[model samples]
Target chain A: MDSITHAPSTEVLRAIVEAAADGVVLCDADGAVVLVNGAAREMVPGDVTSLLDRGREPGETYETTLGDRRLRVRREIFGIVHQAWYLRDVTQESARADALRAERERTQFLVEAGRRLSASLNTRRCARATAELATGLLADAAMVVLPPGGLRRTAWLRSSEAGLEEGEIPVAHADQVPGLAEALAGFPPVPSRWLDPHQAPEWLLPAGFGPVGHLLVTPLPGNGVPAGALVLARREGGAGFDDETETLVRVFAARAGAAISAAVLYQEQSATNTILAGDLRPPPLPVVDGLELAGSLRAAQQTALIGGDFYDVLPTPDGPLVTLGDVCGKGPRAAVLAGQVRHSLRALLLLERDPEQLMHLINKALLSSYTPRSHVTLVLAAIRPGDGVIDLAVAGHPAPLLLRADGVVEEVDARGTLLGAIRSGAITLRTASVDLAPGDLLLLYSDGITEAFGGPTGREMYGSVRLMTALATCAGMPATAVVERLEQLNSDWLAGGVFDDRALLAIRRSR
Target chain B: MDTAPFLIEIENPEPGTTRLTLSGDFDYTTSADLATMTPTLMSRGLSVLEVDLTGVTFIDSSGLATLIHLYDAAEEHPAEMRFVGMTPYIVHLFEVTALDQVFNLPTSAA
Candidate 1:
């Protein structure tokens, strides 16, 4: 102790304390402020002793809010009789953490919105998801006004604590809510502050809902068309829609709009397809005396139901003119061409009943068609009821099979150029006369029957020989039974594999 | 069923003559490739266009349409389009559609 030379005095300690960045205060054992640093005086200003907790144990730390500023205070034993209090301003740090929390919440909400909105291709369901997602986070209540589907009314879905509700409002009623009419018309949203909440119509809110404090209206833009609009409401006691919340709403609306519009487009396309397919479906065969008729058609594209192959039995005074044809290509385009051919055949048949003459007329019609490559393979059979004679003319089509009562099948010897093919417009026909004996069946089919790509190896064709053999097995059966049996056998040969459009028609002479 | 991949090989064996050798399944899905190549195949000075279908395993209605389209374009070009090679299956298809009467097929195919 005697060897120590320079010991710092209280003045040096006071100077060092005054120069420190943190606010420091010293208190005597009597619990009164004995010394205060420059930083402590600036922080506390008027009452430095009031900021300290004299009862706190030494080295204990605590946080306190002074006015708008946040102070972190720690108490420590200075010497034996004095206590030191350290204070730090942490106001900006806490505010930054709060902003980070808000940012995370916004990101989470968007992720959840995307998940819910993309789950449905139905317009109403998508609208419902949009309204539900906007509630709680964006507003106390949210409403989605769907685009006007009819002239008189538009649908609306609302979500709140009371649960989801749906209703229709008159198209003109959109104007009752401020900015709603413009938003529904696909205009940009009117800022919430610009619109008065008192102008909101009663129908926009649920029953027993409190007075609206704020209202936000935004348009849902779609692919070149307006999808709908979104309406948000906060009750009188709730927080008003701020800038950040409004921006979030705009982003959410954009996604919801795209999903709803896509669903609308899909619905329209499928409806049109259904109507076209319905028109191209095979017609029921007309009953011809002394003859049984049956037919079946299966398209390669199962969803379309209509294909390139078609058959119709047209009634005539002389007899029934049965036609089976395969148009080039497949699906809606081919089905449309097939429909055109059928209509042309009907128009041509009104003037000409002779199978060969009809073939020439159809060939002329097809060759003159604006659609290129509109070729068709067809077989026309004119049945003579009294004598069981059928005049058959084959045009670029497979020969009709003769299923004799004795279980013998023969391919009719007939050939002709495909109609509408050969830009030269020349088609030669070698028509044949077939005498259908009692219980004899005549079968006309498209090439799809023979070209099916399934068997034991899953790549072998069903082939004409297999078809002939199969036909021979159903020699004496009724026409319907014969057609059904042949189809069942072919489907089995395919074994659930992919296939082209197959068509089969049968004409039988009953005993 | 898995279909064979379609391929088209073009060659100029002689002046003013183009030979297209087609292989694999030439059906609805793949016939567009040939149809799209029609303009290029029917270029000016194409005096003779020879098609070889010996390597082709299958042909459908769409494929048949494309061939007819090519033939029509050739006829319009005042050029001769002929089938230089074919399988028995294609020969039967030609005979059925009576395209054999219009298209100039090799003697073996006939």
Candidate 2:
């Protein structure tokens, strides 16, 4: 195909070749530089044609010098007879491909760090993930420092190193480097590297920190606020961290801080919940002989150990009046209302001299002051000293069990609506007049004691029958002994699991 | 629990009344049971279906999705559906999803 082209066509081909950005060249099969385009000539100048004729294979790359510059040359077969050769310059393309590859690797590292950061919510897990994420993204060992209760001086290190326990680092030791310590004391995600371990103060070196390495410490903020530092280390000879690595570590640290903060909040809330639950449990009251006395006084929900059940031996004109009641519900609301009912009942009982009138006046005040939504059930009994008469009244509560000296268990069924259940409603407080013969005993309690489900069948509740049976056993026991026995039985029935707030009151007629 | 193919029944007696009577737990494990039952009910073309949930004691999101899917499917037929006989806890799930307003919920005291 040896067709001779026109002079204009040859000139057009030369112009097109010169206009191309790539370096173009022509050589003979024997590796002689036959012709070179303007780009190729500019890339490799000084008539280096003698070097190209050294019989190199086609498509083989070779290095050449053009003036003061270095260029890479590749030869390839072109014509049908393979007599002509093509030379191309590929230095710039090679550099661009390398940059693209690096960028892809950095992107992949960031994506993996993000995936690890989202895997766990535990504080320890979060700290470990943060360290691993940092190390994976950069050529460094990562460490996390958290101050106890957000205190800057109290250091807690959660680092990537094995066998490193938190709270081992003293801030005084960490602050040996005033510069590093000061930067951490302020807001974190602090971007700085401390390369010299000797420059790092003796105090700043964590307990047992060994070896020499390049250090990169960044400020980290927990969900509450920026409160810690993420320190990365690259052992000598390891690649120094770049901006891409720093950015990736910082991003992962921020997410890790948020997760740790959430776990801390969950722990705090759990503690608060425990306290709230504790308030519902009735306190261990005085127990002696075979009888026991149970009562509670509530202040408010947040206040520890405040409740409504109360018992005290107060001097009346005759003897002592035993009182017990349950404000519906638990926590602060019950506590507040319990205080009102307790004081009103106490003050009225002392002044009015009549238990019925006292309860009526208390109900009137409760109806006027309290909304219909709130209510409480109460039981009041007046015992005469040296006298056998026991007067009792009930307001929507369990009937007190009477343990007679003759071993007969009598259930004093008294009826009344729960206080506050009705607004301005009158309670016909009937006095159950019972003759407390020698060795007679009475037990009063809140519904929680009876309704509590315990024993072999955890689901089956300990109803009034069980309480009466337990009371019968305390026939001749002292008032204190009676309550102690009941508590033991209740505890046994619970099988070591107490669920509800229980309040029990026991009164005995002194022989 | 075979964990295989199952049937779901959607019955409507009159216009403006739709009933999706379910017979199984509606959770992740039984999601496909409702998936198979959805298209057959859509063919009848009713405007309102009252879901008889009395037979269903427990239901999860898979079951929840059946209702949601039915609700969505009813929209295409231009029908308003209601849920009935739901346990108090399951009704709470509906309230949480904000589906109580979208679907007619039985309002009897617990």
Listed models, DockQ each? 0.72, 0.02
How far out, in Å, is residue A238 in model 1? 2.3
On DockQ, the candidate that comes out on top is 1
Interface RMSD of 1: 0.8
Which pairs of residues collide in candidate 1? none
Q: Say which docking band candidate 2 falls in.
A: incorrect
Taking chain B only, the TM-score of every model is 0.97, 0.73
Give the range of the ten consecutive residues with the poorest summed lDDT in model 1 chain A.
Answer: A299-308
